[model samples]
Target chain A: MSVEVEVNENDLAEMVEQVWESYLDPEGINPLIPTYDENQPSEVHSSVSISGSWTGHIVYACSIEAARRAAAAFLAMEPDEVSQEDLSDVLGELANIVGGNVKAMLPPGAFLSLPQVVLAPESTARFPNTERISGVYGIWDGEPVSISMWHSRADNNQEDGA
Target chain B: MTLSQPEFAFVSTLVRKEASIVLAPGKEYLVEARLIPVARAVGAANVNEFLAELQRRPNPAHQRKIIDALTTNETSWFRDREPFAALTDVILPELIKSRATTRKVRFWSGASSSGQEAYSLAITLQEALPSGWNYEIVGTDISTEMVKRAETAEYSQVEVNRGLPASQLVQYFERAGAHWRVTSQLRKNVSFKLMNLTAPLPAMQPFDVIFMRNVLIYFDVATKRTVLQNVAKLLRPDGWLFLGAAETTIGIDDNYERVAAGRTSAYRVRTGVPAGASRRG
Candidate 1:
């Protein structure tokens, strides 16, 4: 079984863009544009873990305004009507959908853990013994957002080279 | 105005205490957007203003509306493919054989958002059961708002697009304005009501099958065990219980033993008999 494999950043950004265009914004005039920086600040974060073939985490983080916009788009309500719980669920679901798609690209037999949402001013979503493998940041509807992967640190000691 | 850190933490504690849905730290952005409405309803300008008012007084009604908005989910017909397949090929057949003598069977669809799962079960039953046999499906959820939506039995195209197939679309749903309304025949076999899974359950008729898929994941371990224990009482000894693919009874509860059928898994309640005595039987 392979432990560490190359996680292409463009591939993740493209998938996130596709999800945004298809589900979140049908009229995606300002499409997601990739950023060179990976450490994007976020007020809301939703993440899911992928196990089995690859042990890693998929994280989606965005600003509060951006989070509300996503929730408003998801629930088809005015941004004002979207609630705190709705924000968590929308972000969590976004992570789940994007994470599920990412899992399919991993080795056969990979499974996704149920998504968990976090609302901290400072949020860090690192799975046990895992470090950043590939990260992609982008701008969505004028708000900063990113989707990144973290592979197990054990992979370095045991399996080496990506 | 954007929600501040402390206010976010405050709302998190409130919802977790009330609903059992974990809004982990750093998830403050979630309810911040939704609280705009809540603030307005309570005569405040924003969530911050509402927080100030909440300190002075308690408004349970607006609090519930806030939770409902946050937790309500958009569901679709056959939301997950494998569960439905298990129902069509394995669970239903087993129940039909065991309950044939009674000519009646019942089902409970827990967290049945907007009646999709409940009606989906009804459709499966109508298709598989011998004609003229009696059957019913009862759906329950925590949100009364969602319960009302389920009662209406209508869905939008976006909702239908999620998992509903074209053939099932034509057969079971009739055109209603821009949305699709479940045909009257299917509606009769299903009903919806507000029931919280975290609370102790009311005594009810035992069911031949109970679908609590994807719902158990929302609660904590203790709530999961309580809900499953209640399920044990509601399900007939021979009845089937279906859970989300990711969820299991392994450590939470031991009353159910996994049974694999076709491409999916369903569980049956273990007989109270001791391990050694069961081997003799």
Candidate 2:
């Protein structure tokens, strides 16, 4: 099965919108143009992997300023009081929620892995032999947040795409 | 715009009387968070005004809405994976054998919010049970809105995401516009009812498995004990009971003896003793 055809950017956008509306702020997220601005790499990046019917990763990234405000809103705290660990957790949960919805669109039996968070000044997290198949770029509470789906090329070669 | 102490107290008392859910002092944020939308929906100026209006008029339907608002339906499919894993790995095998003569098993999703837990049980049994075997699931919630939502079996994208495995989503649910609707196969044997656990339970058949997960935290010790006792009345002698991870019958009820079921714990009615016989003495 072509992973790109099965799950695409529009599916990712809807999942992101749902997570934002349910947890963070209702109707606060709006889809951005489907283009990446590599000059402003997100300070924090979080991702969760899917294994089984499809193998890949869903990554969420956002600026540090945005992360603090989002974390505060999620934890019901003031933005200044949000900690580094809180930012990591909130981003990880966002990735997990988006990942889970995306996983549902895939073939049956896809297992979602625990969320992994990266706190860095740049987009440093990498997945070897994986290609980005689909992505959704959106703005939430004025912060640029994006979710991307990566399909593992190694898994593609190794397993029969049953 | 903020929920004041009196408004909070009023809501807490109303909810306690209506649904037996205790809204403690610090949960002002919870009340505010859950009720702001309710306030907006009803065209109240704010949560404070909503409470004022509720007290002034004393409308049963509006009071029911307040109770429903306070009682959070925070549930997901196969929430807390170990319990479901245990059902497949340990409990079902035993129940299948014990009920071999009848070839039927019944389940109760006690405190089933929006029917995820109940549907989860249906999916579990559908996959695990042998051919020619039959099953039934009855889900109950105090909130009329939730019961209706559960009966509909239509869930939003976010609702379906939580704790639901992808394979089951593909197998059991079909897309209805933007939302996902649980397929007829999963809904056929399952039904939801508007019943309060703290109140006298409606007449129902004894169930082989009863899941009262993640709901006891909202009650005080006495209410918990009473609810557990009431639940015990409907559970078969050899049936299984799954409470939330943090909840237990150890101090509250003596009739239940805990049994380790796979990675989680399940309670069984102690053999060699009459049902509801307290072992505390």
Candidate 3:
């Protein structure tokens, strides 16, 4: 059965902090005081699904520049040398790491999907049957980044029964 | 660059059929990006042009290159730091004691990319077991290039920095110009092979421990079931199976039971017909 515990923005903020410190930039990661502006551009997006006892989606949205920088750090290459594939790969992995940690916090037995990276400019992701549970905004080297969780409505209905 | 719907569907079908890896719809960027180099290698101007060529005549060599490029994974020594802890603290000690009569132990690093995992097992077992113990470490992956790299036992500076600590790096590796090669001692007990997890495996001895970390996430339910069935055959009755921390055997296979060791856990094949041991969909 899915764990009915609520995941708030602060929880997501903490998770993002740990991931960035461990994998990306330690010194540059900080929680943004306020959530990102709706108008802020999100040039690249990455996501992963967690299925099993609990089914949900974890999404990471960042500007192209931010993604390129993250990819450079992950691949240990210069920013100029980072290809679109490198960007997608690194961002996808970042989402995978965060998604895996988020799953760990939930009910056990939930399985993570391989990350999916979307490269369209100024794009956002939404699931029809899921509602936003938490959304955290942060800045990495002055670029806006966001992480959000969505829980399937079916899981919520089952929670009501429990 | 984003992949068009037709292109996304095309690569998705090909990747799934070829590797049993599900590339969902939104991963269009990955499909295009992964294929771009393959496109360039074959002298195509762009991904569209390359797709056109692939459509005209699906070259096996180009297909292999595409699969290899798309199959890349990020790994490091002691990744997640839990399974290794479970290994040294719980699994290894138990195996060594139980196998004292044979003085022999074997490990299978399923989906071992670039050999870090197989070598990690060798590193831990080197100190955990007695000097004269017979230990075998076999690493396998579907990518032929990764198999070759694993055979070489070489890693770049970036890879070494990922999860390897400074002390172990210096202790277990020697400089090989631009890269570091696993010490002869570390590579001595390890072997690499090319094996696709989705397909049936060849004849092999039962293993005492299997590191099936991080790969099953890409497989569908039936593939996961098939892989687990095969693993049941390969693993001895008392053997340990370590999956990625995010993965579990709950719904996919019912023959295994979770065994906790501190913060991490190991799964053991249930013996004696467990109460709810019947496999379920």
Candidate 4:
């Protein structure tokens, strides 16, 4: 008895804003403006999977400079003091948070998987058997950060009912 | 630009007068990091402009925001894994044995920020304690904003993602629109209030366990001693006290002695103190 969950571009925008305000910045002033740049290269990438009611993947990719600055703010340290491990952890956590929220919108029984991180320079993640459904791209602290949702197409006959 | 000496001093002084939290010189970066966004929110270009405006004319609402911003520490479910382990493995087993006659237990979360710690305790009791056993948890914080948020008992996904395992979440919480709310089964056993540790405390029932962790770092030496003294008054003579890994009662208070509890250490009133010595009803 699983129903469709509608997640539009606006939904993605709002989810990113909520995550940033709650964790990365308390004051909620550092807003992320929506942008469009698919080919933008990122130094760090992370993702999480959703299963059960609806199946999909939520991907979070950001430039190294952006990752470092975010880690610094999160730990309340200087940007230069941020280590590569810290950057990876922060990015992975962000993806988990965003993915967890998106999972909540779907029907009951949806479960979010553990977050995974890829640390190669100028790297991007690709999820097999899934197509990019919707995404939000934005500039945070003058660096690129993107959150995109992909739907699994394992069963072509199933309607993308949302 | 960074926060100037005058700006930092202004914020530090205000925070001290209001909340009694000392912001030392090295904390300039912290002030800037926290207050810069606040400044922008109030229409100021930067921290400097925000302080200048506040100095020219004080606004209680604006100042309250500053205090909340600085005092709002990051919190997560079962934050710092070892402490919760201590609760589950060491502290509760001992307490359950001692309270066999009463079949009840009480806990106090002295610095519960947004109610995670208190709820976590409730969930633990639900899963660990035997049937027919009853428990209660009281959460107190100095910030009014935090107290209100705690009372709501709702948390965003980002808030819950921090250190909360998915299994515990699905079992203890139910979805509320876009957020999650604590199940009434757990919520009924927990309550939250606004109280300042640096100030005189109100009458309260003695607790079997007191979690006053990670908050002593904000207070000066004298204030820390006083807070511990206040807590000791409300704790049963043999009750357990858990402080942050970095905090201790060895040098601050002599009434308590530290003992090992699995991966962490807990404090209990020193020997020679009569049983129920400080227990108030």
Candidate 5:
């Protein structure tokens, strides 16, 4: 059911901060809360959706350069040698794993969907009933990267026992 | 600090060229996690030192350790018990009848980590078949360490707990302090060997059933295809292929058609081809 854990803005920020610190370099810049940019490349965002006790999604949205950099960091490879498909896979898997781990903290018996890479941030806008948790993380290279978590309100209602 | 472009490229190239393994981007941590222990075991101070040694002169033993470390040994006895039960009741009965024509039944446990699966099959066959029923159980893994462990037939308490009924454990294993050892009779019916699924098929007789469960997720598309083809080559016509619950051959290989047996789904190699044709009919 739609069981809200009373997660405050501070807690959300803390979760994002911890995830970025542990998953990426610990010395990277603190993550900023959700803010959207229209000028960024429409083809740069990748996200993974996980459905378990709570149906939710995690997105790793950034520029082409940032995606390449994130892929390099995740795969422990050079950015120059990282192929587009490799970057897509790396980002998608990162989102999936992060989403899965976060979902584990939320509730048990949650089923994580396979990760998918997409072209536009707004593509996610197709799901209007999703509760969005968004943040912007700064990397050691001083580049701002955006990450978001979405939970479908409809799915939550469906999960309700009553 | 993040690895430079050259360093990442170098490592990726080394993984592909030397190990003949493809490292998916997200799996870099897996490489690091698996190799760090191996590097330490080989007395290398760090991954850099290990890589340096690998580059200068690749020791076969060290290479083997790396492969062994990379293999994910997540396995359980009678994992997804329905299949094994089905094998005991339905599949084995039919196979025994069919194989009676030849007076032999051969089963293979591909990706058989530490021998529980093969031994499980052997014990089931031993219990189900009449005395002196001729059957051979073969367990194979890419990791020599795993093969060795499987041959030893000794399992930790935790390992024995997973999917192994107390009744079966008591019957098949002798208490070895903290560990359980498969009885000599069970161990005698099974053989453990080292095999890489990506490589050519080993020279062996065709198997009536193959259990290659839960290990395919690590491979990319090409590797999966190659492995499936090789596995198909070793499977007898109408042989069964039991995969993990979450795994399938739908997009990966078409040589085997999915067959539903009660609650479980396994694959059967397509028949009706020329006897010598390599591809499934």
Candidate 6:
């Protein structure tokens, strides 16, 4: 029997919150909210694929507004002054850092793919055998935002034998 | 004048043709970020105005800054970990054994940025190798400003935080007010030089190992092939080449074959030929 310990929705939410608080900004200006729907949510997202002893993908997805606000807050710029590419880079770096930390929590020897940003949630669908873990929270501006994590069990099973 | 897609495209194409550096499609922001500040400093109103002025009268100083900014300096001591561990455990031991007969070992870092990678290697050698072993470390980069910084060996907090562990930092660096300077002993083993990889390498002794990581990604396939061939010429037949984790020589060049030591992938020049023949081969 293979034991796969997956991060829970709440734990994933806390991880995202902690990452944003520590790495991005301390003012807690752009708090991430975690939300889920019976149907998959449609939103802007960034993700990094983790491989090695245990293999999977970690994704950070949220609304466009939340992403823009987060980018502005992270860069310490007015929202209007933030460009789309800058927002994408900020979000991508966020996903990379959070994914890197999460990779540390997994069994040692996980390889991380370069981080990527996408326009919508469908982007995360490219990776196979994904399970979504998600949560919701309120920003300092009282905007509702969501954070989600996804893992692929297939990749984990392959690494177990190697 | 205002910045436009065509202008960005022109600059990207020129860089690719002249230097063989690849500027991926979405990286226009990087170009704009580097050029805008230089433009303002040169009294241009905007990026377009700067480009127009640059076209009308190309100032070497402004051009140098643009190139410096465009070059990515993402490096850290003992970056990616496994390679350095392998260097310490396997490569260095073999090199030491071989060099014992000759009494000297030489190493080069082809794209050393701000001296972190080169100094890291030096520290590793000092810690791992036997006392009184003779070794030389030479570092070179295209940016004059970066080479100057490397020569000074001082680093900011943000620069030091990347991959440097606190213990290593304490052992290797002398703290000044808010910055840290690499000790003279470590600095003594290595020398920094300004070199554009697109140009021919300087007259230097053959090297047992060359750490040319990460920089290859910037170059085009032809440039990669040319650079690897040039590197192979400079490398002793048994010497090793270390590339970034994401980089590989498989498709780009065949002059050097990949060799594995533990988890790290390194390259060695194909054997059974004289150094001159290998360069021609």
> For model 2, what is the error of residue B13's alpha carbon versus the real structure, in angstroms, after optimal superposition?
14
DockQ, all candidates in order: 0.02, 0.09, 0.01, 0.16, 0.01, 0.02
User: Candidate 3 lDDT, tens digit per residue, B55-127?
Assistant: 7986545665666666644567877788888888888788878998999999999988778888878878887
Q: A1-162 in candidate 4: lDDT tens per residue?
A: 113667777667778878787766666556776778766667788899887778888999888898898889888999999998898889889999889878878776777889988885433236777777788888887888888888887834333333
Lowest summed lDDT across 10 adjacent residues in model 6 chain B is found at B272-281
* Candidates sorted by lDDT, best first: 4, 2, 3, 1, 6, 5
| Candidate 5's TM-score | 0.51
lDDT of 3 by residue, A83-103 (tens): 998999988998998787677
Predicted structure 4, TM vs. truth: 0.63
lDDT of 2 by residue, B48-87 (tens): 8888887887655467567666654456678888889999
Name model 1 segments beyond 4 Å from true. Answer: A1-162, B5-31, B34-74, B273-281
lDDT of 6 by residue, B109-201 (tens): 888878888889888887887887767899998778679988999875556777898998889997543357899878888998998776676
Fnat per model, in the order shown: 0.00, 0.11, 0.00, 0.16, 0.00, 0.00
lDDT of 6 at B186: 84
Per-candidate TM-score, chain A:
0.86, 0.83, 0.82, 0.86, 0.71, 0.76
Candidate 2 — which residues are off by over 4 angstroms?
A1-162, B4-33, B38-46, B49-73, B277-281
User: Where does candidate 5 chain A have its weakest 10-residue lDDT segment?
Assistant: A26-35
**Candidate 1 at A19: error in angstroms?**
16
All candidates: interface RMSD: 13.9, 6.7, 16.2, 4.3, 15.2, 13.9
Q: Scored by CA lDDT, what does every candidate get?
A: 0.76, 0.80, 0.77, 0.82, 0.69, 0.72
Best by lDDT: 4
**Model 1 whole-model lDDT (C-alpha atoms):** 0.76
TM-scores of all predicted structures:
0.54, 0.59, 0.54, 0.63, 0.51, 0.55
- Candidate with the larger DockQ of 2 and 4: 4
Candidate 3 regions with alpha-carbon error over 4 angstroms:
A1-162, B5-31, B38-73, B273-281
Candidate 1 chain A worst ten-residue window by lDDT: A153-162
lDDT of 5 by residue, A1-162 (tens): 345533333444455565554555543333333444423333466666666466767776666676777677777888898898987887787677556545545644666667778745535575577876544444435454666667787774345331
Error of 4 at A43 (Å): 22
* Model 4 error, position B19 (Å): 16
